[model samples]
Target chain A: MDLFYLAISSTFVNNILLAQYLGHCPFLGVSKRIGTALGMAAAIIFVTILSAIFTWSTFTYVLRPYGLEFLQTLTFILIIASLVQLVEIILKKKSKALYNALGVYLALITTNCAVMGVALLITRKELGFIEMLVFAIASSVGYALALLLFAGHRERLQISAIPKSMQGTAIALVTAGIMSLAFIGFRGMAA
Target chain B: MSKTQHIGATLKAGLWQRIPPFRLVLGLCPSLAITTSAENGLGMGLALAFVVTLSNGIISSLRNVIPGKVRIASYIVIIATLVSIVEIVMKAFFFPLSEQLGIYIPLIVVNCIVLGRAEGFASKNPPLISMADGISIGVGYTLSLTLIGSIRELLGSGSWFGLRVFGESFEPLAFLILAPGAFITIGILLGLQNLFSRWRGEKFIQS
Candidate 1:
């Protein structure tokens, strides 16, 4: 019951993108086409989970034992940056089709705060290993869901007649605003 | 161009021509997340400015020494170090604001503006000019965040920087400070910016 609630809450009510505001860069940047949005979502999910696992262990085994909690920001970023590179190189050699799909976004993930944000959030919430895994998957799914929905809107928006000044990002932001308002309705569900 | 003239152009560019959040559209996360109040916005902006300015200077000075193949890795290390310093300082001194800002303080490690300026401007320029560019962009970013924060606070809570701007009878919109309000505020602000620039015949920023 607890895990179910955690999943549902993170996926909807306390959405990492909508409510918590962790990864607005990609939410706005790559949500233009559903195809690219799908790709970015897959990449984020993959990298975020892997990085979370690594960062969690590093913090538990290294940072905590040594009382170097303050060094977490520096350490986690370095880990994520290098981890993305490693994954990219490994994917290129082993899985050609997968590489083609997620290749571009993998590089961009190094800077995407969602991965780092999840890692930090796990530590801050002091979730156990099992709970941490569940939270990571749930949060990435939330991010993916939001991106796909926004992309669908953006695709139709391409055909609509918006004001010249409010055409691109401005209009997209307004749409996101409305979507966020709708998401707020989920607050009651989680509670 | 002469050295001083070049520096002036860089400063001008950072301040208005290519400001981070507004013109460049970089660093959207922090701009959107912490700008619920003027104080938080200014605090976040200043924290970022300090990191970016110092990182730019350090990266500029070591540009030649860092290998091209691994310059990004090197830059991340430099930036991460500076951000760690900021995180520690904020915890030590500005505890309340630090708590309010929360994970964002550490998440600065991944903020594109810091790394963007490092890769784009600092690596190519001399240390002094890079520092000036950092300062200009910092001020520009600070001003933008403060502006957005003020708008949100004044309308949402009928206050600005924690002081009541509107009287007790004033019913705050309450929406302007929430998540949706942030998106709409930035969206409308972006539209207005484009409208003004179009009137002046300036190029439209795609982001």
Candidate 2:
């Protein structure tokens, strides 16, 4: 029940993208098409889970013991950057189609603040190992939900008569703002 | 390209031509998130400027030795190292500001603006020119963030930087402080920028 609540709240109420506003770059950039949005979401999920596990272990095992907790940011980023590279290589050799689809998105995920945000949130929230895993999965799912929904809206927006200046990024941003307002409805439910 | 002209152009490009957030749109994460207040925006911008300048200088100097295949990974390591220095110094000295900034202080490592400039501009240029580009772009980004924060803060709180610029009768728009307001404000700003540019072009042609 606790894990279920965590997952639900993280997915909607405290959504990483909408509420916390962790990964807006990819949320806006990649959400133009459902296919690309889904691909980026998958990549985010994969990298978030992997990076969380790695960061958790590194923080608990190495940094804490040596009183080098200050190095958490630097260490986690380096780990994430290299880990993405390793994932890219392994994916290329193991599965061509999967690699081709997720290939470009993987590189971008290296700097996707959501990935680092999860690591920081896990520590800040003081969650256990299981909770950390659940949070990572839920956050990624939340990101996917927002991305797919925005992509659907944007597809309709392609035809809608928007103002001359508000056509591309401006309209998309307004749509996101409305979507964020709608997500506010999820608030207080967790309480 | 003429070397002298190229150097001069690259130096000025960071201001408007190659603006980090508006033009390249590379570093919107920190640009939008930390700009809720002018002070926070300045703090974040300065921290980023320091990081970008140092990393660009180092990366440019070491560009020859870093292999092409591992360049991105190498750049991350270099940037993460510099970000650590900033994080430690901030925590040790300015504890309150560091706490307020929260994870964002450390999250600077993954800010694509810094890494993007390093990889795109610094690696191919001389150290002096790369440093200039980094600082100029950093200033441009800082100015943009400060502007966003001031606009949001003023409308959201009926105050500028917490000074209560508006009179007691003023009612602040609660939405501006919320997530939606950030999006709307930036979106409108971008649209206005485009509109102005288009209008200017037409005027120039008419004359």
**lDDT winner among the candidates?**
1
Q: What is the TM-score of chain A alone in each candidate?
A: 0.98, 0.97
Alpha-carbon lDDT of model 1: 0.92
Segments of candidate 2 deviating more than 4 angstroms: B1-8, B202-207
lDDT of 1 by residue, B1-207 (tens): 999998899888877788778778789888889999999999999998898889999999999999999999999999889888998899999999999999999999889899899999999999999999999899889999999999999999998889888888999999988888999899999899888888899885574
Computed on alpha carbons, the lDDT of every model, listed in order, comes to 0.92, 0.84
Q: Candidate 2 lDDT, tens digit per residue, A1-191?
A: 99999999999998888778788788878888888998998999999999999999888889888998877877888888889989999999999999998969999998899999999989888788999999999998998889899999988998899878777887787788899899989887783
Question: Which clashing pairs does model 1 show?
Answer: none
TM-scores of all models?
0.98, 0.94
* Interface DockQ of each model: 0.82, 0.59
Model 1 chain A: ten consecutive residues of lowest lDDT: A19-28
